[model samples]
Target: MIEIQNRAGVERARVTGRVVGNMLQALRTRCRVGTNLLEIDEWARLMILEAGARSCYVDYAPGFGRGPFGHVICTAVNDAVLHGRPRDLRLADGDLLTLDLAVIVDGIAADAAISFIVGAVRDPEDMRMIETTERALAAAIEIAAPGARLGDLSHAIGEVLAGAGYPINLEFGGHGIGSTMHQGPHVANDGRPGRGYRLRPGLLLALEPWVMADTDRLVTDPDDGWTLRSATGCRTAHTEHTIAITETGAEILTLPGR
Candidate 1:
């Protein structure tokens, strides 16, 4: 369901968004070589609980994923893109990691994701992929204000990814988010500017732009039934943020502590 938040609802969303942002930031800071993926999930769980927030992932049972995600955050490494269930894998010196998280505060939910390299080792390709997704996300946000069509945002993101020479995947993309984790008006990475839903005030959308280095196709991991990997096993990166549409412009709610 698509939800348009009122002033009060927006306030609640802001609070939830901050919680999610802070948790992701903290996790990002503590992540490094030798750190286990499950440990990152545990750290996120503790932070969410400390903030008195509810995890949107743990206990999440969506049709696309195996029931009950049972984790607070997604730890996607290298070839893994979305719905990456935390496991017992440890990070290496140059592992490209992505953390995707969502939480609810005062009944409002916010979602965001970040990708980075572990223990820094000059990998130009990895840095480029990470930077491209972030740029795409920023582009989408720049065009996300009242009167802008959903396609405008998608096209803005798509241009960056496509121009960067990465393949775009449509199976999983951004979505409307407020009061729940996922909602309607699916926002694909690539689209025509004049098509689809129109932007309006108080509508919160999780704008994510992800890409596989070599292919647009994805293959679900057989072991966990949740993780989405590049069909060709190529590297990937994803970036996302929750934004609220407003009267004059768009407000990025998922920014870390001012």
Candidate 2:
């Protein structure tokens, strides 16, 4: 469903977005070499409870994914990208980790994701991939404003990723997010401008740009039923933010200090 938030709802969305941002910042700081994925999940649970908010993923049973995610946060590492189920695996130095989170506060929800290297070791290719996604996300957000078409945002993102020599995956992309984690208006990474839904004030959208180093195809883990990985086993990165379209422009609700 597509939701248009009212003034009060948008205000509440700020609260939810701040919590998500803070949690992701803390989780990124907590991740280290040898840190278990389950530990990250537990930390997210604790932080969510402390904030008096509920996780959107813990009971999420969407058809595309395995029933009942049963985790507070998604911890994708290395080649893994989306719907990364928390496992017992421990992170290693140079691992590219992605954390995606969503939560509800005062009846509003916000979603965001971040990817970064694990420890002291960093690969040039890995940095390039992560930076590409971040730049694409920024470009998308820059075009998000009242009266702007959704395709404008998508086109902006696509321009960055495609120019960076990365393959864009069309199956999974950004979406309208409000009372629920995922909603209508599937925002593809690449599209023609001047088409699709027109942006309006109070519209909350989770804009994400993700790309694989080699191929656009994704493979899900057989055992866990989630955790999308690159088909060629190449590196991957994802970046996202929840934004609220405003009268003049767009306000990024999921910013760390928001």
Candidate 3:
């Protein structure tokens, strides 16, 4: 379902987006080398509840995932990328960690994700991969505006990832988001410009750009049935933001703050 929020709905969306952004920022600051993934999830849960927001992940049982997620945040480590269920293991130094979160406040939902190294990262390759996704996400956002085609956003993201030599995965990408976490107007990471859905004001989208270091193929983890990892066990990085289309351009709602 593609939803265009009215002024009141947009205001609610902004509130929800702000909450999600603030929580993510706090979680990022709290995550350290010695922290456990499950601990991160608990912290996120408490923060969301304190903010009077509801998690979009917990109790979510989608077809792709084999469960009610039962967690507040996705804690992806190293080769793992999407739908990474939090575990009991502690984060080691230099581990590439990705946190994906979505929450709803006043019936408006917002989502975002970030990837960073746990401690002192000596691997240049990991840093490069992390940088590439962030750059691609920024590129994609730059092209998002009223009257723009969905393909334009995808093309912008793909160009950066491809130029960086990182393999792109199309299985899971961005999507329209408003009252619900996942909605219509599917936005892929790679496509031809001037095609697909046309953009309009008040349309909210969760634009994410993720890439695997060595391969594009993703394998689902057998143990958890949710965590997606690179087939070759190579490292990966992902970055995302929730934005609302305005009359002139896109307004990023999930940014950490002023």
Candidate 4:
């Protein structure tokens, strides 16, 4: 279902987006070597409660995943990418970790993700992967203006990933988000321009661009039934931001710190 927030609803969406962005930033800063995934989840829970917000993932139980996510945040390390269920493992230095979060505030929802190295040792490949996804996300956002077609955004994202020599995966991508966590107008990471749904004012979209280092294939973790890892065990990275379409252009609601 696609939702176009009214003026008042858009105001609420901005609040939710800001909260989501701040929470994710705090989580990123707190994550480091020796940090346990479970601890991170707990931190998320605390932050959400403190903000008087609601988690969109805690009770998520899509067909592919196990019943009830039962966690506050997604902590994907190294090879793990999307839907990363928090575990007991502690992060190690140089481990690439991706934190994906979605939450609702004042009846509006916003989603975002960020990937970064856990500690000091800067692996060139890991940094490159992270940079690639970030650039792709920026490109996609730049093209997400009112009246712009969804394909334009997807094409912009694909150009960055392809130019950076990373394979694009279509299995999962961005989507419309508002009152609910996930909604329609599926935004793929790669697509032909001038196609797909046209953008309009008051529309909200969570634009994410993720890629694996070597291949586009993914393998779901059997134990937890939530973490999605690279089939080739290659390091991966993801970058996302929730945006709202306005009369003139796009407003990036999930940008941290103004």
lDDT of 1 at 201: 97
Q: How well is each residue in 52-156 modelled by candidate 1, as lDDT tens digits?
A: 999988889989887788999999999999999999999999999999999999999999999999997567999999999999999999888899999999899
TM-score of each: 0.98, 0.98, 0.98, 0.98
Model 3 deviation from native, Cα RMSD in Å? 0.8
Q: Which whole-number lDDT from 0 to 100 does residue 80 have in model 4?
A: 96
Give candidates' CA RMSD values in order. Answer: 0.8, 0.8, 0.8, 0.8
Clashing residue pairs in candidate 4, if any?
none
Candidate 1 off by > 4 Å: none
| Candidate 3 TM-score, true structure as reference | 0.98
lDDT of each: 0.92, 0.92, 0.92, 0.92
lDDT for residue 81 in candidate 4, whole number 0-100: 95
Q: In model 4, what lDDT does residue 213 have?
A: 93
Query: Candidate 3, which segments miss by more than 4 Å at Cα?
Result: none
Worst 10 residues of 1 by lDDT: 115-124
Model 1: number of clashes? 0
- Model 4: residues with Cα > 4 Å off, grouped in runs: none
Clashing pairs in 2: none
